[model samples]
Target: MMRNVAILGASGYTGAELVRLIAGHRGLRIAALSADRKAGMRMGEVFPHLRHLDLPPLVRIDEIDMGAIDLVFCALPHATSQAVIASLPRDMKIVDLSADFRLRDAAEYRRWYGQPHAAPELQAEAVYGLTEFYRDEIRAARLVAGTGCNAATGQYALRPLIAAGLIDLDEIVMDLKCGVSGAGRSLKENLLHAELSEGWHPYAVGGIHRHLGEFDQEFSALAGRPVEVQFTPHLVPGNRGILATCYVRGAAGDIHAALAGAYADEPFVLTLPMGEVPSTRHVRGSNYCHLGVVEDRRAGRAIVVAALDNLTKGSSGQALQNANLMLSLEETEGLTMAPLFP
Candidate 1:
């Protein structure tokens, strides 16, 4: 049976990516697409790359017919999805690609995002949308909150090691480089071509990045105690991808074994061989995460690296994967395309 789906905020980067992936999906049909400012515009007009697809014209959220849709992919900006999702039909299944509901604690959301959650009740109900770790819960959840692209990249490198007690809980650091598209399609002075081109620098310095809330919440839950990783994210001049290098105090061989064993069966996460690292170029433009481990000269230290297209595996692609599981369709449907390589 074909499932009718909608993409809210369909004019943004993640929204456009969702449309591109769903265009190739067999089980899902695009029923409605919403974009407040771009309402009434053809999707192709907003994203010329997606013009080739036969898709619904953009409309206001209220203009969408809820009764005709089976699922929704809420790609709205951070801090905005709470109210919009709260207004949607209560019984509807949704996958949100925003930070609104990823943290289970409303207070934590407020601390990180600087405002009260508009829908605390719904916040408590949302399952974290790291599809591989929460597959069963996502399969049963009415709402699934997508992780930050930086957070997802870090987690793929560290989650299994943390769970298996292979890495030091007290000493962990992650330095990440992300493509500009991860900032969304919105206009900002710093994101202009003249400003961002030919250079790279870190943002959300210190312990301030909002995705830290997710890292703290999830890593703590996995280890049964508090685990805080020093995380810094750098914006690269390129178009789309994330590379996270995690430094940890652990034997290199054990870290590799634990990660390999953990993701051996996961369809979207690939664990590369020992001493070989992954490149963002390898996983660009697809729903895949490539992980690699390397030994540091310091005997007790190791470097674990992860790479993926932040727009795809880290955000929109991850959203579609959760949507597939929620609807009881094949988990890899529309998501198995091999990572785009040069």
Candidate 2:
């Protein structure tokens, strides 16, 4: 039987990507799509790239009948997702692509997001949706919180090293470059064509980015102690993908072996041959994460780089990945589409 799914805030970048990916899914059907301000408009009109597929017209959240939905994918904005989800049926399986349920502690959520959580109980119950590290938890969870795209990319580089105690926890660093779509389809002066096309600038420097909260929570829990990674994010002028370069204190070969062993069974994360670097163009538009490792001339340092499509593996694709586990569907079903390359 085909399970019907509802996509909230479906007019945004991740939401549209969800529709795109779901178009290939055999066990699920998009039964509802909601876009508040764009209500009554066709998804085709809001995003012409999705016009060819036949889909339900966009509607407001209040107008949707959730009783018919077997699963819900919340692609709404951070603060907004909490309120919308709090009102959802308790039995509705959900995969949230927002920051609302990602943090385990409401106080931590308040500290990082500058506001109190609207749904603390849900926060406590939600499973961290990394898909790889938290796979078992996700399979049993009714609600799964997707990791931040940048956080997801950086963790792919460092998680195995941290778990295996192969790197210096005190000297970890991550420099991330993300394409414009990671910012979603919002209207921003900085995201403008003339203003951004020829320029690349770093925003949220000095450990101030919200994704740091995710890294702090996840890494610390993994290390069984406080683990902090200095993270700085830069916005590149392209339209998709995230490339995270991680610096750690470990042998290059050892780091390569650790990452390879960790993801050897993972369908989406690929550890490339040692000394080989990955390009964002190679994983663009697909739910694949490519990682590369190299040794610095300095005897004790290794450079690990990981790349993935922020819209896919980072956000929507990841959301779908978690949803598959929650629904008892094939883990890689609807996600086996190969990465798009030039």
Candidate 3:
């Protein structure tokens, strides 16, 4: 039987990505779509790439008849998904593609987002949706929070090493470059083509990027101690992908073995042979992450590079992967499309 799914905030990039992925899914069906401002419009009107599929007309979340929805994918903005989800039926399974439920502590949410969490109880129940790492938790979770695209990329490179105690905990640095689409489909002064085209520069410098909280929480938990990394993210003029280069104090061979062994059995993660690096272009539009490890000139140091489509593997596709698991369906169903290549 096909699981009926509803997508809230269905007009955004991640939402559109869900629609695209779900349409091809034989075990999942899109039964409802909600987009507040874009209500009454066709899905294709918002994303022409999805015109080939038949989808429900966009409506407001309140209009959704949750009784028929076996799963809900909330692609709403940060701080918005909390209240919106809290009002939904308690039994509805959810995969949130927003920052609202990613953090487990309300105080941490406030510290990073500058506001207290709207639903503390729900916040505590959300499983962090880094599928490979949190698969068991997500399989039993009523709610799953998708990781930040940039954070997800960085973690793909570093998590295994941390878990295996193969790298230094305190001396880690992540330099990420992401496509503009990771910012969302909303209009912004800086995102304008006139302002962004042919220009690339770093924003959210220092330790201020919100995703750092995720890195801190997850990495710290894995290492049994507080772990912090210097993270700097830059906005590059492109459509969809994130490339994270992580610098850590570890032997290159150990780094390779750690990552390779970690994701060896996982379907979506690909660790390149040592000395070869990944490119965002290689994983574009697919739910795959490519990782590479190399030795730095300075002994005892290694550089790890990871790449993935910020929209697909990072957010929407990830939500779908969890939803599939929650529904007892095959995790890779409808998500095996090859990465778009030039």
Candidate 4:
């Protein structure tokens, strides 16, 4: 049976990506799409590329008849999603693609986002939406908090090593590069063509990036102690994909074996041949995360690289994957499409 779904904030990049992926979904159908500013406008008007799809016109969140929807994808921004989702029908199955509920602690959320969480109760109930690592929890969760794109990429590269006790927990370092699309469709001078085109530079340098909160919460839990990684994210000149290079203290062969063993049975995550590196181009527009590992010239160190489409695997595609589990639909449904290439 087809499950009717609603997508809030359908005017943004992540929201539109949800529509794109859902277009191919056989078990889920878009019953309503909400974009406040674009209310009353056809989805095609806001996203010409999606014009071919026969979808509902954008509407105010309240304008939609929620009774007809089975689940909702909250693609709204951080604080916005919190309040909006808080007031939503308590029984509605939701997948929140925001930073609002990712962190388990309200104090931690306040410390990182610079505001008190509007929905502490919901935050406590939301399952962290890193599909591969938290499958069972997500399957039973009423609300799932999507992982940060950068954080997801880095974790894919390092989490297995951390869990298997293969890498030096104290010396882990991740340098990640993301495409401009991860910034969302918001207008900003810094993301303008004149400013960001043909250039790439690191932001949130040091330990200030908010995704650190997630890494801290998840890695520490897995390691049974505090594990702080030096994470730096750079914005690259591209439309999609994330490439994360993780430098860790471990043998190349050991790191390779650990990663290969961890993701061997997992779908959507592929481990490449040893000494092979993945390029962002390889996984663009798909739900796949490609990982590669190699030895560093300096003994006892390995360079592990991971590539994925931040908008796809890191966000909406992941949300959809979790939604599938929550709804008991085939896990791979609507997600089997291969990565698009030139």
Candidate 1 TM-score, C-alpha based: 0.99
**Candidate 1 weakest ten by summed lDDT:** 333-342
Cα lDDT of model 3 by residue, 254-335, tens digit: 8999899989999999999999999999999999999999999999999999999999999988999999899999999989
Q: Could you tell me the C-alpha RMSD of candidate 3 in Å?
A: 0.8
Query: In candidate 3, where is summed lDDT lowest over 10 consecutive residues?
Result: 46-55
> Any runs in candidate 4 off by more than 4 Å, and if so which?
none
Worst 10 residues of 4 by lDDT: 333-342
Better of 1 and 2 by lDDT: 1
**Cα lDDT of all candidates, in order?**
0.94, 0.93, 0.93, 0.94
TM-score of 4: 0.99
Which is superior by lDDT, 3 or 4? 4
Per-model TM values vs. the true structure = 0.99, 0.99, 0.99, 0.99
Tens-digit per-residue lDDT, 85-204, candidate 1: 999989999999999999999899999999999999999999999999999999999999999999999999999999999989999999999999988888899999999999997999
The RMSD of every model to the true structure, in order and in angstroms, is 0.7, 0.8, 0.8, 0.7
